[model samples]
Target: DMTQAASTGGMMEMPRASRGQAHLKLAEFAAKQLRGETRVASFSLNGWDTHSRQKRNLGAALERLSGCILALKQGVGPAVWDKTAVVAMTEFGRTVRENGTGGTDHGTGGTMVLAGGAIRGGRVYGRWPGLEEATLYNRRDLMPTGDVREVCAWIMRGITGTGISDLETKVFPGMQMAQDPGFLR
Candidate 1:
């Protein structure tokens, strides 16, 4: 089964390094989904802890993430890809200003990336808080304009057909999913 999945998922063509291997494994799972062998798959890529020289560090991390996404799409094919939703998130945000080491410290607001054909692709969703000193949270971090939990709740509602009440009470307690952001297609 591993051999069949590897061949079908193009795992042999992937790199042998650990990071690349994670992507290759995700692709294998995606291919299994295509064959009705799985319904959900998830993988994690590390190296986001850029405490110094963030430009170089973050760029490399993004590149790896990009490769992973591309591999998943290719493994699933267009038809299945259209039904998939890829959500990439981090636990914390970075400061708006660069640190002495040219990196950023943890801050109040961060970003979430949603991909695949299932999402409404073109536009950025969330209100932008200007970077002006008056606008920044504590004059250091981007002011969070919306609750991330609400956005996530909406995405879950759309994907799982779960009722808003259940999403509010069960999934994310005290989260008032104000309006449907219409993240799904």
Candidate 2:
């Protein structure tokens, strides 16, 4: 019944055939949100390893990510999308410099993508740690100029009205909430 489940729940009507299974599921989740059945959804897309052939491998992964975001927006409709915040983050970063294999090794600083109408879109946030060799972390990775947790804290504060004390003590332990970056509308 797994296949049946995948094709059900508003999946068959997905406008884009190129979307993968994960994107279909995300679209279904967005439909549920539109119906007030749920307020949150979480899913993951794999194939981001990119130990080599980064240009081709990473490009494909990014295409799938773009499709997933589009599916979410299309499923939710304009009204719900205006209240949605889609946060995409990787657990780890890659080295600033390419390696001998034409790929990057695991490193420190990574990028987080925020989309949807709920976000303060069209602007990149965070301090720029230049790619200069001297500014690299341990001379290997990009130096983390800001904590990812702080950005998430501010988003949580904006979306849910969560207080700073709880964000520090409970939600994101050991994180010192910094100045609000106004990530959300």
Worst 10 residues of 2 by lDDT: 1-10
lDDT of 1: 0.77
Candidate 2 structure quality by residue, lDDT tens digits, 41-70: 556778787778898899988887888888
lDDT of 2 at 61: 89
Q: Whole-model Cα lDDT per candidate?
A: 0.77, 0.78
Candidate 1 residue lDDT tens string, 23-46: 556565556555465545555678
Q: Which candidate has the top score in TM-score?
A: 2
Alpha-carbon runs more than 4 Å astray in model 1: 1-21, 30-37
- Which residue pairs show collisions in model 1? none
- Backbone clash total, candidate 1: 0
Whole-model alpha-carbon lDDT for candidate 2: 0.78
